[model samples]
Target chain A: MQRIVVLAGGIGGARFLRGLKSAVPDADITVIGNTGDDIHLFGLKVCPDLDTVMYTLGGGIHEEQGWGRSDESFAVKEELAAYGVGPEWFGLGDRDFATHIVRTQMIAAGFPLSAVTEALCRRWQPGVRLLPMSDDRVETHVLIDDPDGEGRKAVHFQEYWVRLRAAAAAHAIVPVGAEQAKPAPGVLEALAEADVILFPPSNPVVSVGTILAVPGIREAVADAGVPVVGLSPIVGDAPVRGMADKVLAAVGVESTAAAVARHYGSGLLDGWLVDTVDAGRVGEVEAAGIRCRAVPLMMTDTEATARMAAEALRLAEEVRG
Target chain B: MQRIVVLAGGIGGARFLRGLKSAVPDADITVIGNTGDDIHLFGLKVCPDLDTVMYTLGGGIHEEQGWGRSDESFAVKEELAAYGVGPEWFGLGDRDFATHIVRTQMIAAGFPLSAVTEALCRRWQPGVRLLPMSDDRVETHVLIDDPDGEGRKAVHFQEYWVRLRAAAAAHAIVPVGAEQAKPAPGVLEALAEADVILFPPSNPVVSVGTILAVPGIREAVADAGVPVVGLSPIVGDAPVRGMADKVLAAVGVESTAAAVARHYGSGLLDGWLVDTVDAGRVGEVEAAGIRCRAVPLMMTDTEATARMAAEALRLAEEVRG
Candidate 1:
């Protein structure tokens, strides 16, 4: 089986994987889930990015919401609200609690998150081998004034996005403990042995960048003989989804496809995929010594996303040749 | 100000509290909650009895179901099913996840359950000071063998009742860890300072009995130099709600008002109240050397429950004299 490794963010990455699964049915796909967006909500371990991938691939995700499970109810959410517990804006459903509960329990029982994730995957069966980038806690915190009238504080990523609705300007984005976090077992091996490594159109600074922040993962991918391909999250000078531009600004990066290519550079990139809207920037990205290609990267549906995946694979093969 | 202590179970305890709040607006009401039915489900700490009380008093409880929150949905549960995670019988809603998340987080963070309960109560603000009978983990497990399967194993109180629908014949009931669990903070003090302690018509074997099983609480109530009155859960020869008969049988107690009084006995009982249907059994209960009375114990609504509370108080005064 073709061993394909994909680095992923939350919504788009998950959605793209659904398409990739269809495109390459026999491929041995492995997902290095970004834990940077993981949050401890009401004590439940909520890996938004990870869950998105799990749900999208397992065929349980809400098609419209693109984050939580389909056919979800808010009984548990209301109960928590009645209890006046937590950052309620994130909208955790009753059935979703079971996932968090099981994950948290296994984690508390000294199971590494990767193993716990495997146990969870036994149920989700997303088909792909899903591994958290690291088993250790690596929360993405944004520097912002405390919304509750307190002084400036580092808030969890979900609180900034979900609770405050990402209203404030982020001064800094820190992936806490990423410096110390070793790649989860099988992560380095997966990358090293991968036939091709692909970066989905995830937020570069927060999602993919945070995974790279973990020790050893970036180096392994760079040293691997396989072609490392990255798709631009920036399309037509803006992020396809979420507040990626705002986050990019926090890291002093411009919201442009060319800027995203420069951000990954040769340290991690051999091939870069950009949207057709920014096709003119291909020369600039290629001049930076990374092979660049323009393709229709709009994942409006499964077919579109699968084509994008196939394009990425085709580009990787060209780079290898 | 009246220092009132309430011995409570689930729905009845929470509902009675609404009226108690109305009855004595300025009084200090301390609720001693039953944690016997507490169980770990889907790796989340599910305090069904406590949640029922909290939701009821906090006004988030489903009025129709008499448990869980109203307007609840099951998206999360559906997602979990897709993941193949379960004890599929008991429903955990999305809004409900917040409670478990907060609770599990607190418990994991080294806070004992009483402090966690208090912290959770801070949000719900269920007017009354709510206290779990014990801080230690105490699970109510029922011994039963599947009529269709071989061997006997103790099932968690919830699984045996809610999931299995109480179909199996229960051989015995055990409040696991009751022998080791110390009374939660302020439980004994609350009992000692209480002007009156009234037991709502909750299950005798599982509700108040579980609280009594915790060391120091039962003794404190017995020695508290105040009237201790109880409303009988038995309406005539049967329990008003729940599978109390099954539990009673497990504990080797018959389903009778007289037997219940004897079960509580002289050490813990100062006053006993049976229903109108069991009015003739009051003499038999009083003959056991405890003050006994018969009144309408049916709590069809808040008004009926308040009246019952008043009658219990009246009986408490008689017992005190």
Candidate 2:
């Protein structure tokens, strides 16, 4: 059985994993979900990326939104607002609140994020081994011009992305606790033993990039001696979804498939998939000593996404050869 | 204005207080709610009696259930059950979860339960000064026959009352932390300045009984030189609502109005009101040196319950004479 490791973010990553699962039902997949997007809301730990993967693969995700519980209701959020407790910008539904409550309870009982994730997965049975990027806290913060003051201020990535709608001017992205954080248990081991490693078309700056920012994780992926492949979240000259373009610029990267590939660079990403619309940039990417291919990168459905996953695996085989 | 202090439990206590508020709309009311029924569920502090009072007085109480919020949905509870996390028998609605989340967050941030209750009450605006019986944890545990083994074991009051529906034979009722606990900031003061202290139709053993167990509280009420009257939870030979009889029997108290008054004794209770059905016991109760009255104790409606509260006040006046 193929051992595939994927570094995932929220919606895009979760949807891709769904496709990957359908593409290779027998493959042993491990998801190193980015915890940079995790936020403490209403005193409960809210791990957006991890939950997106869990809910999406566990058959509990809202199909249209591609995140949160399917039959979600915002009664808890509404009540919290009534109590004047907010970050009301981030909408957490009642079912989603249950996940956080259970997770927070377990963490309070001294379990690490990885163990809590494992316990949660017992109920989810998402079929893939899901692990947070690190058991230690590694919140992603974005610097923005103070909305209320003169100088720039650092805000939680969720505040920047969810609350501000990424409407602020681009500055810099910082993983607040990444320097002291260690990759969660099984993270390094999974990467070291992987037959193929894939980076889903997740936010390069905050999602996949944040996972690699963990000290040991990037080194492990580089030294794993396996074919490393990635799908560009960017198609044409902008992100396929989300405000990825606004954040990509924060890291001085353009919102283009070829530019994102080059940003990861040939040393880390051996093979990169760009949408067919960016086919013209294939040569420019290949010239940088990385194998680049142009394919239909839109994850319109599971079947379409599976075809993309199959293409990436085929590219991984070519890179290995 | 008359300063009225009430020692309260859940449902029954909350309902009676609602009527009391209606009866004396101008009275300065202070409710020292029993914290003995407070339990930590799913790592969140749950104050059943406090919430019951807040909801009931704040117009959020389910009119039919007489507890929990009106228009409550148990999405969070159902999800918790799905995660195999329980006390599933104790239902927490989504809107109700917000209160716990805010409260637990505040407690974690070093606020005492008293302060937390005050903060929660601000939202409810329950039109009374509500205080926890004590700032310290004082969980009520009931000794019961071990269902799986021979002798006996202790279960939380909620487990005994809710999960088991009080079917198990009880040996003793223990307020686990009462020995070292001190009454909350305003509790003694409320008792000290009280014009009248009325014990609503709350459980004798677990509700008002637990409040008096906190050392200084009983002494303060006795020394207040104010009328301390009570409405009997027991009407005839049984409780008006709940399994008060089961718990009443646990403490070796008879499930009779006069017996309940005798259980409280003359020194503490200045007056006791039994339902008209137990009118015959009035003479027996008054013979014990506590003024006794027979009235309709059924909380049939706000009007009916207000009448009961008014009757308790009239008896308080008679005791003063």
Q: TM-score winner among the candidates?
A: 2
How far off is each candidate at the interface, as Cα RMSD in Å?
3.1, 0.6
Which regions of candidate 1 are displaced past 4 Å? A18-23, A62-65, A94-96, A122-127, A142-155, A158-173, A249-255, B1-3, B12-28, B63-65, B94-97, B109-112, B115-127, B145-152, B164-171
Would you give me the overall lDDT of model 1?
A: 0.85
Error of 1 at B10 (Å): 2.8
Model 1 chain B: ten consecutive residues of lowest lDDT: B78-87
**Residue A273 error, candidate 2, Å:** 1.2
Off by over 4 Å in 2: none
TM-score of each: 0.87, 0.98
Candidate 1 CAPRI assessment class: medium
Writing each residue's lDDT as its tens digit, candidate 1 over B1-321 gives 888899889987777777777766788999999999998876778888888888888787999888987766666666667667675788887666567767986897899888988887787778889999988989988889865689888888888888887789899888999999999989988998899988877888878889898988888988998988877787778888787888888889989887888888867778888888898998998899889888888878888877787787788889889
- What is every candidate's C-alpha DockQ against the true complex, given to 2 decimals? 0.53, 0.89
The iRMS of model 2 comes to 0.6
